[model samples]
Target: MHIQNVRKWCREFAEGHTNVHDEAGCGRPSVLEKPVTKVLFADRYVIVREIAKLIGDVSKTNLDKILTDIFNYNKACVWWVPQMLTDEHKKKLMESGPTHTSPAPRRISLPNSVGKPLNNHTALTWLPVTTSFQNLYCVLQ
Candidate 1:
């Protein structure tokens, strides 16, 4: 709100340029929209830094904001997608579910310590294990 600028605005208003919005003037223009759209359509996994470089000079912060706010993308694992999952997205995810694996069963190991044997051939021990699904303790005797 400089005095000179204010006077200029008043003069413009008096002369009938009465639009409330600021006139589009030269400034740091948006550098991401079109190129980002193209890159994303081509390859969703394209790195953000690479996209920024392709679109000329743009700060990482500004580019991130544009991608998240304008594009509605949030990072999941290594990819970015819409914050809210759509039905089509869910269907695609389900269709690409993990392949079934049937590895041979392996014997579990336990720590060797100073413990008395309950029987001549068996010893009692508590083994703590962490699994992808849950944590549990195994009691063996």
Candidate 2:
């Protein structure tokens, strides 16, 4: 918490304001669920910022809460899609599996350095241009 807020709270406590929570209707009122839902449904690819622009006086955080808590939506590939996946959708994915399949990744073997100690220079020579750390670690071990 900010020092100023802490000091203010301490002052309030000193003044016999015992309650820790804010008074009723203290912060901004919650954004209406209907408008948010309409905006989201209108454009599945709409971002939080765009929603805020359309619905005046709503913060990004509050917008996120409305999308998740109220509508049960989640951001997926820049689109605000429904969180729950129906059985039909799952079945469709299963049916389309073969079309999405790609060839298996080819593995390259390191040079034989059996007698010599594995050093950075020797390791670099055998490492593929696009090698990842996980693969590099496995080769070192």
Candidate 3:
């Protein structure tokens, strides 16, 4: 405890306050894990604000804490996925391929003519970009 808190508690005790524990309705309200987990699992793309709206009586900060600290969830692309993949999740990911795990395939659109508007002759092309899953390896290893 902080020194200030200790001094204050000592003074309270000197004044004959026998209660050592905190009184009721003190500090942050508790958030239930089951409801939060259910909402999260129901929609992988759900944001904190949406969760707050659905859950009610819960702050975004508390939701974030529940997600990261309690559940070990992390934002991967637009999806909320587990920070640490279990053996089953890993197997599914491997079988489904990396593309399945990604929210969308990265692509770069290239116009043949930068300044000119597209006509019958103007060609637009998209180059598929590959992202390395190096971060996953770092975490998993």
Give me the runs in candidate 3 sitting further than 4 Å from their true place: 1-31, 78-141
Q: Model 2, which residues run further than 4 Å from truth?
A: 1-31, 78-141
Candidate 2 has its poorest 10 consecutive residues by lDDT at: 76-85
Clash tally for model 3:
0
In terms of lDDT, the poorest run of 10 residues in model 3 is: 108-117
Which digits, one per residue and each the tens of the lDDT, describe model 2 over residues 67-94? 7775665653211111233455445434
lDDT of 1 by residue, 1-141 (tens): 799999998999899996877768757776568887887656544567877787778877877777777776644331112123346644644554444774322222223312232122332221222211112111111
Model 3 — TM-score against the truth?
Answer: 0.38
Cα lDDT over the full model 3: 0.55
Q: lDDT of model 3 at residue 106?
A: 29
Per candidate, the number of residue pairs that clash is 0, 0, 0
What lDDT tens digits, residue by residue, belong to model 3 across residues 10-102?
A: 999999999999999898765568888788666655678888999998889988887777676666441212234456655644554436456
| Clashing residue pairs, backbone N/CA/C < 3 A, model 1 | none
Candidate that would win on lDDT: 3
Q: Whole-model Cα lDDT per candidate?
A: 0.49, 0.54, 0.55
